[model samples]
Target: MLVLSLAIWAVKAQGGTFNYTQPDIDSGKALQDLSRIAKENALKRLSSSSSGCTADNVYFLLFHRVYIWIFEEKLRTTSMGGNGEKVNGSQGMLPGGTGGGCIKEGPFSNYTVNLGPLTARDPLAHNPRCLKRNLNTEICRASASLKNTTEVMLESPNIELFQANLQGDFRYPESRKWGFSVHGGGHFIIAGDPGSDFYFSDVAGTLTMMNRPPSRNGTLDDVLDLEPLGEAYTLGEMLDTVGGSPFCFVYE
Candidate 1:
């Protein structure tokens, strides 16, 4: 019976997909304590970093993903007395406006975040402030659909077509026609406030307005170089020209 129970627990721990959800605001006082603990752990990890937290780093996504993963792990263990069962997905209520107003509840409600000074030499220099959020439901609400879109992207038959779709024309409502715009929207919605590291900066925002010509040149490399293209190419290269300039790439 003990071995059977352990087997089931291990499967449950390792098999489930992380379903992203809003932070649970009504978790009460216990959540407050958990928030503090998570924040401290995150801060300690951040302080240990030479880069601190900034968009300049190419590995920003990876860094934060791991950071938050650790934070969530600690939060789960501490809150549930080390049961090791994965906690529910991230929690938070969606706000109604374009501006994602402040977060009022949940595990992170009581904890303060140190954003560090904008001009500080080290991006992680300790500058403490209340953790703020500008919750935009419009974009966040689209997260559900975005998840589905990602699944479709993964199953796409023509890799080149998939890449082209992601590099769709950079326009407003038009830009959203492609997956890239939606990707940026998710970030903006999550980090609606300026102080947040994920805040939608001008660099990414303005790139949406630039016109991108289709690949008139013959090769995938040429397409990436924005050269005129003659034919559609395949996924020979793993590079993602998703937003145009200020590109980021990651390999597993």
Candidate 2:
């Protein structure tokens, strides 16, 4: 009997058998409850702020984290390979030990979240072990050159850019879920226009506010103006040529 017990333990340790068990459903409920409380606090802060600037910033930050969490939980239930599907929580594992993003584009042109290799420059610069020599040259070049072309600014956790009430029935274009709110400010950056429908190559972080004018498509003038933030300039120095007229800049 002792020998049989030892053998079973050894096999289990060697991953020959799954330790079948149910997840703690109560823990899941607790997470949802926490999320609700956070939302309420964010709304109160946003509503009472003297300058809407700070409130809008806080709202977005909280919403972003909460939305990402909600999306991830939904994915775990509907998709395979979550944190522990094989041995509980192991399903979240990727080849390189990196987790997955909750928001992603789908296979059939619909946006479905996916787990893939890191394509950004900051991650590659911070951790070179993740990059492979035999990988595609284009991908490598893109990652390496990202810092030169991209600007990233982190928002403070205290600010909320979006409130929970703003989540009602709003959808981002070609996205999987509701539109993002403003508060926990976004990572402000000036990014290159890499053949996007939005603007010219020189324009940095120009978003389309409304209907696209047909005549302006594929032209330098089509893009919305990118202005300089006098304070907290995170992206590379604002180029003079791209600055255009001061009237081009839009303040949120």
Candidate 3:
């Protein structure tokens, strides 16, 4: 009872915006609904009375929430355990598999996680489906260095398209797993561009890694170089053009 009280208090402190429908969720749809809510409302001010969340942004909020709670356990699975350096077993944060995009069971099956956008830096490289490396024949960089020379921006539908295709197993064999990093290399931001007018949105993907750690030196100028190709392409194709795979969160 005390634990439940404390949890309620914590939720209220964190803005109390998320509505937990069914505690025993057996399907992805329920989790998806929660994720949508988290995305619309700013996690910092989640308690605000409004449907500030969206289908695109909610997953990120859930990711941040779950990741922080299992930080110690995930850290242990990645670094401390045997074969931790290599991607094996259910060690990494979200072991990529069927319909496995962001949410994971965490250290314990009861502790389900939405794995928000910030988890791209996981050491194990679990989410290789959307990640791009220099080895990719179609997208591989000319230089040996993994850093990207150009920057790009992706829209919400595009992000959803990528997410939709990646909902199942990886299409390519080479893109199955990450060699160095655990989480995919990308960054999510709350609309850093002015001209684009795309504000307070959650964006993720390889294109964000062009500057190496998208957060440190990214700007609206980066988005200018990126063009929206209406046609869908493989993760490799997407990376080859923009120098990285790109996905963005936007209001519909």
Candidate 4:
């Protein structure tokens, strides 16, 4: 809750006027408006860009993400044991989250999350709790359709446009358009408490390394520093996902 609140606060701090109160979400044109903003702004940027490329290696990631969350897990015959980083998860203090609450049985049944819900009470305090879940199919079908994913992958030419489209930035909207972020759709695949919360968002890719604009052009020398997790790498080193040190698997 604390962390999520801070995120919302940050959005407001940036002069972004979004309907943060989560209006009767079932009936709101604002979200629809946001969809248009992301599409137009992204398309405009792509057209004006000079270094845009349509190479296959540029942006091929599509429904593979959905497959990972849904099918990949199903393919795992063994139980997901405690082998990765451990943390205690918590709820967003929602008034009885629809669908369900803390997971009772499963690999994460014994799992606990700490240091989250970053709020005014204790920004980084170690508040441990169980994980909560709420799968939402409505959002997945409406916003994260194949059409949106295709647009985001093929329509966007520059990194900025891709970023905007992938985020569905509604901070600036005009009329209407049919579009939404595949990234946002993935997040909503498990929407309810923490799932819907704006805790974190990130991505990767090869042709996506270049940040081209009128002012400057991004180069492979640029550094990607994921401090606290691992050493940084140059933009060039991250090009290959299968034949590299940091990564060793190819998308099937």
Off by over 4 Å in 2: 1-27, 50-252
TM-scores for all candidates: the values are 0.32, 0.19, 0.22, 0.44
Error of 2 at 194 (Å): 29
> Which has the greatest TM-score?
4
Candidate 1 C-alpha lDDT tens digits along 122-227: 5444667655555455654554255635743664467544434444434433334554344555564545334533542323222112222121323333211111
lDDT of all the models against the reference?
Answer: 0.38, 0.26, 0.28, 0.46
User: How much lDDT does candidate 3 score?
Assistant: 0.28
Order of the predicted models by lDDT, top scorer first: 4, 1, 3, 2
In model 4, where do residues sit more than 4 Å from their true spots?
1-99, 113-129, 171-180, 195-218, 223-233, 241-252
Q: Residue 161 in candidate 3 has what lDDT?
A: 35
Residue-level lDDT of model 4, residues 1-252, one tens digit each, is 332333334344445556634563345444444433433343444443332322211222322332343444454664532222222345453222235456665686666655456443764456777666655555666667776667666766776666667767665241024344676667655653352223332221111323222124446654443333244455565666667535555642
Find the candidate with the highest lDDT and give its number: 4
Q: Against the true structure, candidate 2 has what lDDT? A: 0.26
Report lDDT (Cα) of residue 102, candidate 4: 64
- Report the C-alpha lDDT of model 2 over 28-115, residue by residue, as the tens digit: 5433333334334434544543323221132222223334444455576655222211111342222221222221223212222121
Please rank every candidate by TM-score, starting with the best.
4, 1, 3, 2
